[model samples]
Target: LGNVRGKDWRIQTNVYGNGSTTRGREERYLVPFDPTEEPHRYSILWTPDYIIFYIDDVPIREVVRSDAMGGDFPSKPMSVYATIWDGSSWATSYGRIKINYKYAPYVSEFSDLVLRGCRVGPIQQVDSADRCAEAVEELMSADYALLTPRKRAAMRRFRERYTIYSFCYDQHRYGNVTFPDCDYVSSEHSRFGEWGDNKFPPKEVRRARRRSRKPSAVDDQPSK
Candidate 1:
């Protein structure tokens, strides 16, 4: 199957053959035989250099032109698979088509597939993983300003690659009630309010005090 963007593609073999061959010219074969009638296995092996298509331990096709793919080759490791597809094309040259509606719904069975020389490894280093987990825990437990530089860098890298797993801080949820987004309160202000005494005046309060001291009410009093 090919992605709609004409990239990230795969090919499958089944009855009604609906499979593609890239030798000389690209040819697609249709198979209509129901493999489910008698069990069979299908597998695909993908490596850094090539993709091998197999049928019951027999190698049928080998896709070896990774360089021709420019940068679209499947470089990352992948697992093997076996899947069935309903025949929706011309029947194979072999007599495998279901002629009547009684057998209209054909089923293909895939089993006993093997992945040769497959290996699994952690996506990131153990230290990086711990750092990422710790960063998240700290963000959840403390204020954003308390986040250390190392933690912040780790968080940034985690977010850039795996955005869904990144941590977020809800400044509005610091206390029991949600604060208005328009409020200009900084993290330091919030921290002081929560931990320190609520004696330090805010910028707005200071400005109000200065304005109150001005002679505004009697500025227009005529030479009393």
Candidate 2:
């Protein structure tokens, strides 16, 4: 359910509980750019039927609900939260690393906030059925909600180039059961190892790994 970050920082998205019939999935990718150098936009679009995750207007991943999915899709309403804490003890590096207080008081910033959805009170009688339908229609009609051919192609390219782990192709872990919602692509599947790690990392990622590794004493001896 969690992972340790390698020397190269990568971004990951997860929806838990699907494996044990509780509805969960995960995807990971090496970030295209240095996030610390500048601020970038990240957004999530969730509807009754599908969910999309975006980075600066580019749709990176989409999940569509299906009958086979059952309760795995997130159906309930939830609030948005921006957390700035490290989960090193458990989630990151499996407790090998701890948060260093030298970098205390981290800051997270947000801007241009926009939330669009039908608001329903705890009591269902507070909102009319007709009003809720109207809201749903409007949200579905928005440009961002519609992933056209171009957007789909872009998404495919991003996944091919950056995706390092995806539960959909992790046959080793799932034991031959592909998640119902996954849109299987043979070409993309070929890039991943049986265990879900990238089989052939891009040149840049390889270079980064080489740089991060320490030189062993044996390698320091000159060849005769």
Candidate 3:
């Protein structure tokens, strides 16, 4: 349930089991990234329908919300997170690359962060109900939240060249059952019951993959 800056220097869109799930789900989407080179601006845009992950403002990954997800979807209020540490025991390609102590005191910089989330005061329980106020709705509906042709192309190219790991194609891991948003996503990006092997003909052939086709329902129920 976190993005780890592995020794490979690749930014992976990885998520383990959500807090509500029993067996921790293991999945990751690899993208072209190198944090050691220079400062790169990473951004996250979360809407009711999906959460978009961007590197230097170019969209690279999307986590779509769906009815099939049940409690596994990250529906409750969450906070922004960042970390810099020595996860050498288990971070890089499953601990293949151990952190060298010679490069001690690892430093991670943060700047120009943009966060927009609703505040519903205190919640007494996990099952409390919630809704976005008009002001919050306006914020989430801003143009930055929508998709464009160029961004879609960037996402497709990134996925085509870089998405090395995906849960949708890991049939053996999930017992061959597609989880959550795969019905609409991997089936289009990947081969039939296989890993993502499709090539994009033209940018136009690639549909706006992340835009929520229908406006998300505002009435939300709370969970971890």
Candidate 4:
């Protein structure tokens, strides 16, 4: 699966393996600020145990690998890429909203690149995983790889305020079939309707949230 923006400009993180069309999952969220207005940090951290997606240093989503997941979790060498294109077919409103070329030359700039990993020639080599063992250990021990208690709380608050969709909780789409890696949280689950869409938080809760954080719920209007 690929990361893409929605018709309403919300960002989405997607993951899939062993046939994406049948087993892919996605999470959608709205950033606090206008991404187009300024440069912000976007990052993806993938390890053998878990994968984390971040925006401006804030951990937005994490997928923890589990034995029950089987081959659903991505477990192979991969390359990183960044680009901008018209994915009107599925990027926005399920293709109902086409990319209007009137605004030509849509540009996305990436810089100050940082990649951490052991380099190996090819996956066919039998010792590829063995050779990368040391690097994987070092990578897993890094500050970014481990989520502290404070960071976990931040992630929870961000999701409570900004998360719009989650495949793990989509009862209507996959009734009685919970994703193996899903860590069910009753409070979080209650926030989502049966269809997996977030039911807008109550007025009092929104007000309280606004008073507590810089990011307001007003900016989290879910896409139609």
Candidate 5:
């Protein structure tokens, strides 16, 4: 097979035997039994740019030409040929498909051979549009307001781990100051409410105040 993008090509064949002029591009060979033994059929289909050989309806060889590698590959007419020959050296090494020594000057039979023209279409492209659309839809439906503290912590962890520079903080919609960089605002030494320019206390401070009122460690814990 030849790549439609003109990237690769291959050749295959089976024509073995002694005294065979099998040189250059001759890859394989096979011998058949003498005439009078069950006669076998072999055929070749040639197009404007390719040649395909078949044995009893089973494809055995394919030859694609260099000129047929591009978009306008050969889609024209062609012919076929079959003849018996002494292919001893190549055939013996490759093993014989059929032996025809009994009928000296072995007459290889060729009947019911046919040639037909065919048209093949181009390959289809992968469709990623639907998958992309679905992903965008999911992102749009995500509830930034209802995001739990645990989720926020996870996002923070991810951003820190990946060294991300840009992220969305929905504090403005929740009556809290939105800091462009949370890393610069959160400090281990300062009390939660006293950090940066935040007036309503940081998220940690609100959680601490709520915990002081309820006196529950579970309440202080980030919700999943």
Candidate 6:
């Protein structure tokens, strides 16, 4: 989802696996100033084990394929797609602002395209598909692979300062069922308020979190 002049790009992952859809795996980022007026490199690295986002080679976010997720994680092959259209209902300030038709033609630009992956055979066996994707993972995730400790620190700083919305922290909205990947093992997880969702942190841990040195909260809702 997107908002005009709102200074955020709510990138979401519609993880479809085995003909089913998994929701709420999303993030929001405060990109470089006036990116639309200029050009920025927005890159997504999808591997068999994780999903990583980068803006000009700086790691912004990471989502691991946890064992707890079962088939809910996106492990299938998909195409690269981009679209530009009107989202008056749920894109601008949670439907507050909308597209102004006076600016008739809004253009989304693209250049320096790079596509690298393998071509799996149709209806390939499960084991065969897994083997093929593993090889492709080495290529696709080479430069944009796992997050280093330093990069993770930088990411935490970014989210704490600029992230306006997040799903992992909203216990009141999502209730008891939270994804396993939400609980990062560091302070970066604090940006979500409750790193482990409602069911986590036990009683003692909850008290510890309440007395945390740097607290975070579910600051804002999504556009939808």
Report the number of the highest-lDDT candidate: 4
- In terms of TM-score, how similar is model 6 to the real structure? 0.70
- TM-scores for all candidates: the values are 0.30, 0.76, 0.68, 0.80, 0.28, 0.70
Q: Which parts of model 2 have CA positions greater than 4 angstroms off?
A: 1-7, 16-23, 89-101, 122-129, 205-224
TM-score of model 1 vs. true structure: 0.30
Give per-residue CA lDDT, model 1, range 1-224, as digits (tens).
Answer: 21112111122332111122221111121111223234445555544444444433334334443344434444443434445453334222112432344544645444454444434455632234453455435433433223344433433332222111100122222334322211233542442333222223222322332333211221212332
User: Which parts of model 6 have CA positions greater than 4 angstroms off?
Assistant: 1-19, 121-127, 130-134, 184-224
Model 4 TM-score (2 dp): 0.80
Q: What is the clash tally of candidate 1?
A: 11
Candidate 3 displacement at residue 25 in angstroms: 6.3
* TM-score between candidate 2 and the true structure: 0.76
Which of 3 and 6 is the better model by TM-score?
Answer: 6
Off by over 4 Å in 5: 1-23, 29-37, 67-83, 89-105, 115-224
With candidate 4 superimposed using the best TM-score fit, by how many Å does residue 218's alpha carbon deviate from the native?
A: 14
lDDT for residue 188 in candidate 6, whole number 0-100: 48
Residue 59 miss distance in model 2 (angstroms)? 0.5
Error of 5 at 186 (Å): 57
Instruction: For candidate 2, write residues 1-224 as lDDT tens digits.
Output: 22233345567787643235443487887654545445667888888789899877777899998998777887665567777667777433336767666766766678888888888665553456587787888989999999887777767666776687888877777878978888888887788878777788655643533444211111222334
In candidate 6, how many Å is residue 172 off? Answer: 4.8
Worst 10 residues of 6 by lDDT: 213-222
The whole-model lDDT of each prediction reads 0.32, 0.69, 0.52, 0.70, 0.33, 0.56
Candidate with the larger TM-score of 2 and 3: 2
